[model samples]
Target: MLDRPTFTISNVRSGDVVSYPLVLFDGQLHGASAATSVTVSRIGADHPRLRAHTYTAPSQAWPVALDTGVFKALAFLVPGENVIEFRAGAEPVAAIHRLVVHYLNAPWDYCVRAVYVVPADDPVGGFQAPPHERCDIDSAVHRLALAMRLLQSALAELMHRHGLGRYTFCLEEPAQARACPSEGGYEEVLVAYGVPVHVHRFKHSRAALQALSGDELYGRVGQALSGAPDRESRIDVALMSFTRKDAHTGMLYGHTALGGGRLALFGSGSMFSWPENLEQVPRRFTDRTAVDGRRFLDDSAGRGEYWALASTSMGAVLHELGHCLSLPHPHNGGGIMARGFDYLYRLFGVAEPQPGAEMQAPDEPRLDRSAATRLRFHSYLIRAGSEPHPATLYPPHPPPAPDGAVSVPVPSPSPTPTPPRPRLYVATNGLPARARAHHEAHSAPRRPSITWQSEGVVRVSAPNGLGHIGYYLNGDVAAHEEFFQASAPVHLLDIPWREVCRQCGNPPAGAKIRISCVDHAGQIEEAFERQVGDRP
Candidate 1:
């Protein structure tokens, strides 16, 4: 019916060379109400697993309705050029437009592996999900893989927006990649090549998994993957089950976020709500589905429902992945690591689906300057002796990249295997251009049971530009406090007895105060732990 370019792709332009495999096609269908669909087709690239175009939306076979005129879809690219076509109202098509994107798994060979951890006794290879959010193991694999791609694009965009270029985590290839239970590797609809999701069957039973705490499972999972073929090269992104131990409380197990030395492995609960396919992805973000508290893990905690659940569950994984890359929680900002990852939808669509769920004057999730600076030096995204890719060079403008971060290499059209590289981001022996060290000593301190200056204020400060400070109580995964003084490294605070108590309930007796500092060089330092207050 229509002959003009009725489709407009936003996030990217045609002929742009991208480094990552997964790309979110953010754009809108101009004018009127009619059937619309986006199809991915290859131009010159030939991948063993990748076929022509496997992902399509709002199709007769499986309808994934788009958002009004504004819509977004995920496209996994082959080595060379990729052509994504948009069509509406079928044949000769109502309105059509096509865009091309590129990917070369370049200088950075270190990739994030999407791993599915299954207990030996589980039948369907399924975790807990409310009836409204049920998907089989095969489906779960597709969902997780899709989620990783979305995250990859989100990160690339985050870094790019901040003028650091589009750098993101890579995925394992056909060699080390493992397919889920269903087909060997159909990927989503099982027709094209999709990033491999490694499946690891744990020897323990579901009950055993449930019995372990988050930390315990983190260690167990890390140990399991420690014996991997090339353990030091890949950062494991693992998925496991979490079940409620007490019928009265909603506490469950199997949530781990520990990453160091090629080991950033974990995800759980809200995964049930994770979109199972590209079509369902956007909808999943705004998914207003109520999580049946008794059956599924409520990751939203009350901020929102399925939409919030998806954000935290998926975003949390990315956050932990950051930790794996040596990224620490920043001092004061809602960036991904600082718990403001709810804007993943913002990367694609213009609005939120659920009523009252819309984000306004948003506290968006991002990779703040400090995070960008740190990741810039990370070995995972850059090579020590590599030069920058001509096509994707950073724009020499304001908000420049961290020093020594301008030149980075893009993968060749066909990815090649590089020598094994260590996961550590900071150099061990001799120091680099910039040197940083952390020191903490309480002034006029009391005995072992004393912390705090009788005044309620924890002091913190940072170097010229370093910016991630964390406060913890006793020994817990969640940081009870974070002081983000990017310039001055000192900010007073109420000792754990009062301030932290407001956040983490009554900590244990003689609860100790711990602080962590991560500079812009990916260096991590755990400050001294000072005990605060009485044994209440």
Candidate 2:
């Protein structure tokens, strides 16, 4: 209100609580021109709690990218309290003020570990570095650390956008001999300024890695990164950079997969363009420079290859992580489980260098509603104290009227590992769309314990307290997916035809959709396959 270049932080106000270490702050300035420079620096900050830990380092401020008056600033905050200052224009220019955002590290135990998988044959830790950068372990560590931080912030933002608070998976801090600062016996961490990455040299050489198939690749990562698989505590992101370019032919073998349980592998081909430091984050997003076609996977959207690699590498890892968490619902709807992660930069920056027709100004990537339910109730993501007690039993959900929900009576929640499996019932009312559940007699024998339900019109309910509804259609590909939360208003998770078509796009002329509903306790009973098009 007072100066020519009015600097204001819109996303987060002064004294608001924030969780992630590296945060993007978006704001506006009316008076300043497009080229006006906006620099951000911290005046003074302090971390009262966990003060003794050596990793609780100070925060750093970075320059803001101001485009046509609207600007985006990046800042790093310590655990307890962080004060960030933003100044618009040059030294003597108008509107330079300081703002503060409280930093409260989320209280979570299960952590996401950032690990760089080094091939035994290579000793120097050679990896493709950003242009004119070093290809060493230190550089790999910085690149991986930045990617992990971006992933952390992106999840937090997406969950918040879904009306759920800033809930996200925890990232492991530096190794510490001392116990966590939590009051109870739980995981307590402080996300400081720097990215802490672990370099694990695989006993197997590059030849072994190249020879391994997808399953073999996942198995290797599990054996190396995930120790004592039973009730594992940490989820590891195993990143590798194994690329070779020669005269005749080139080979880039990225043994990437969404390994079950605790590990996910990622290839860092575009990491050279990734920000090693906090300041370069803005510049990295808008980098339109083309990438070596033979060396890396071309993930660049309408923007340049550098940015596409950043978005794809990071988002692709997250997608795999989602599968690792047992949320492998079919890639339907424009969600993280789908291909929505290409515009990951939109979550942080207010603008991109060159925008395509589909690329909007402020649209960001996110997890769909069904995926949200899965993440919220996932065994790993559940907070230490917030876990459901086996002894406690919830009441039975009211069954649907004579139309959709059929005669099968629902059961109450139980503590047993394998409780009574839920049954599938369909409504053939044909009000909206008709998907009739075949009577056991007419139901064709497909596979053992498999039946075909006329999809697009049906009532499939998972009465179990915690449930997930999945559809694997067109052979291996997934069509529509759904999940029910433990705190859902009604346990009868209805799958209407109208909603099904909306959630799952049009299937081919002839495709079989295998629908499965599994309870959290590993009980699977309510399931069948649906045949689309004229019955063959």
Please give the CA lDDT of all the candidate structures. 0.56, 0.55
Q: What TM-score does prediction 1 earn?
A: 0.64
Q: What is the C-alpha RMSD of each candidate to the true structure, in Å?
A: 10.7, 12.0
Q: Candidate 1, residues 354-445: lDDT per residue as tens digits? A: 54655453567687665664565344553211124433442322132244222232332112223322222222211212221221111122
TM-score (all chains, Cα) for each model? 0.64, 0.68
In terms of TM-score, the best-performing candidate is 2
lDDT of 1 at 372: 64
Show model 2 residue runs off by greater than 4 Å: 1-4, 46-68, 90-93, 97-99, 175-196, 228-231, 245-247, 254-260, 295-304, 329-332, 355-364, 382-536
In model 2, residue pairs whose N, Cα or C atoms come closer than 3 Å (at least 3 residues apart or on different chains), thus clashing, are 130-272, 456-497
| Model 1 bad stretches (over 4 Å) | 1-8, 28-69, 87-95, 132-134, 177-193, 242-251, 256-261, 265-267, 301-304, 382-536
Clashes of 2: 2
For candidate 2, lDDT tens digit of each residue in 435-528?
2224331133311132334664455543433355556665333543433322342244546544544444657655666555544322344356
